[model samples]
Target: MTRVLVIEDDPIIGEMLTLYLTEEQFIVQRVESAREGKFALGTFNPDILLLDLMLPDASGTELCSQFRQLTAIPIIVISMKTAVADRIQAISAGADDFLVKPFSMQELKVRMKAVLRRVTTPKPVAVQHTQADSASMPESQLGLSLDLERRTIVLDGDHIETTFSEYEIMKLFFQHPGRVFSREELINAVRGIDSFINDRAIDVHVTNLRRKLEKNPKEPQFIKTVWGVGYKFIK
Candidate 1:
């Protein structure tokens, strides 16, 4: 049976999650503190964990970081902490995703599905290499007429340039228009530093990439939010 570990301290919330998960047909284990949660993880061997950021024994982010060394099992941090710093911290600690507190069970389930999808789905076959070069590749895919091979992004018919990291970020999205890539996944494709690159760096690179490529960076249409996960291409 598929197991889901719920690490929530609030009795009412814990029971609610248990009821919801049970109805979803998952074998559920509920724990009230970080220590119990860690113990459950070992004996239960859960496929997914719904972790609360505030725990009696340890913060969920700290716990999850340690847990990642033990297993790559998907973890979704569900918390009241919604600050950008909170989001970045949780992800850096090896969480697959984050869900702010006061979310519906429906949203919870969707995030659970996304985390499962990301961790379980096989890596996309690396974009096929081509001697044809990035310039030779189709420009329509870029949302601009950029010479991809030469690493010069064309803006208003002028060659605007991107850093190597920025170019890799663009190419990854350009290769699959409309496909979203979690920042962790993006780093993996770019510098083989999926586990090491800071998430903020990805955000910065994307910010600059959009500025160079999109006509209206404020209301960007080419790259869009996947909400609670990552970014994707729209054009």
Candidate 2:
């Protein structure tokens, strides 16, 4: 069974999520505070997390960042804050997706499935080579080496961790160096054609990728912004 950890302060909301998700055959564990949520992370070890932005102890964004540092588990922020800035903040803080409050249970389930699908799907390793050979392959102009099987990037001979979205974006950029991809195209490539992910979310993922891959994110080397068009990877 797919395990889900829901960190929501409102008793009603927590109960509703537990009831609905349980009916869908998910192993649901709901906690009422950030403290409890942190405790459950070790004990419950959920496959995915549904987090509320407003918590009794700590803000959800803080917990999001903390949890991200601790685990690669996908997080979906469920909040009453509907501002675009709030959504962007959550995504930047390592949330995979954000849903506004008063949302339909059906929509929440769809978003959950989408987030889970993106993280769970495996990318095929294109080359048949030994690990050493793969590691020694020609590096990108930015000196980054990708390992498809591990879904990680080696930068300056050090392994760097990447979120599922960031890894997908990096893989696409490397595959089509110098090709400008519109936000919609990039979104479709990483999150699927049916994805409801907004353009800004893609920007956030790219920004996160730049932080890890670029020596200076203010003036990127390989991942260049094409202004009105979108972005491109220059080899």
Candidate 3:
């Protein structure tokens, strides 16, 4: 039984989410503002959080950053902020995913599972490559080489810090260069089965990866977007 803390100001939306999540067998605790959410955190010990950007007491962005400092719990922002910038900002502030308003409950469930996967799944231990593993080595593209065995990425011979999610996305791209993967496909591949694809979350991850791997993130040379479809890797 997973415990979820929902920090949403709207009583209607909060109740709606609580009812739906309850139907799914999740233990939920709903709060009307960031202050209440923070106060409840110590007692509820929730596994995940459904946060709203607008609150009576504090901004979700500030709460998100504060929450990250206190705990590593997964957080999914449920907000009306649909702009790409808003989504990116939320992610930057520490939310694992962002769902725009008018979203379906089904999508919310899928996204929650995806974020949980990131938290609950054990990370693979980095190791030295064997001859057999060499055959499966991640491909190098545009001076970027991902040493999956070493669990590190080398950009022009320099190692860069990267998150597991970013590594998963990049690995898929390296495995299938020039193959355009829709956001849904990417989420499924990276986050596993029953994962939901939030386009904005995908964009934020891609943007972060591009900054680390590409010479110019604004005009990437390795990862290219297939407008209206998704993204692909090109040498």
Candidate 4:
């Protein structure tokens, strides 16, 4: 059975999570304080961690950073802080995903499963070395073209510098247009399962990619947002 460690302060929410996760056949260990959570980490080997951002003893972001330094265990932050900055900070601190208050049990379960799947699934192989390896490659899309051999992108005949992260992300996007990948999925797909890169970095890479590839970054055409979800490439 998969083990889950939940470090949340609210009794009502803690009890609610325990009940729901138990129903889903997960072996859950709940702690109400950050201190106890730290202790549990030393003693219990959990498959995943369900952490709250606010605790009586310590800041959840600090705790998350500390925990990440110790292990790569998947962490799904459950917090009441709904601000965009809060979400970005949580990811920067090393959380695998974030869920705000009043979230449904079904959504929590889905997120938990997604994090675990990313943790367990084998890392995908890198993109092909050149376009020759895969025919029918998109030569130009909305003025953005890729030179696989040169590992560079050209926009309207001018080469646009791209970092390895940006290159990989755009490559993935170009390979499968119209597929809506969640942030977690994009992190896993681009950086591999074992990479320690903060999930927030994906946003930075996408922003840079847009500035380079899109005619107008403010009003992008090739890469579009899926609202609350991640971005997708559109042909």
Which of the numbered candidates is closest to the native, going by highest lDDT? 2
- RMSD value for candidate 2: 5.1
Off by over 4 Å in 1: 119-235
Lowest summed lDDT window (length 10), candidate 4: 120-129
RMSD of 1: 12.6
Clash count for each candidate, listed in order shown? 2, 0, 0, 0
Query: What's the C-alpha lDDT at position 8 in model 2?
Result: 92
In TM-score terms, candidate 3 sits at 0.56
The residue ranges of model 3 lying beyond 4 angstroms of the native Cα positions read 121-235
Candidate 4 per-residue lDDT over residues 100-193, each given as its tens digit: 8988999788877765653442111223234453344455532666667555665544556554446667778878889998888888875456
**If candidate 4 were superposed on the true structure by all CA atoms, what would the RMSD be?**
11.1
> Per-residue alpha-carbon lDDT of model 2 for 45-149, expressed as tens digits?
888889997898888477778877666677888999878877777777777778888989998888788777656522222333456765676665226677765
Query: Residue by residue across 1-235, what tens digits does model 3's lDDT show?
Result: 9899999989899999999999999999999977788888888988888889898888847777776555556678888877877776776665767788989999999888876755542122333445555555555422677766545666644555555557678878888988989988986776565433466778878898889778788899988988999999984
What are the clashing pairs of model 1? 134-149, 135-149
Candidate 2 — worst ten consecutive residues by lDDT sum?
120-129
Candidate 2 accuracy as lDDT: 0.79
| Per-model C-alpha RMSD | 12.6, 5.1, 7.9, 11.1
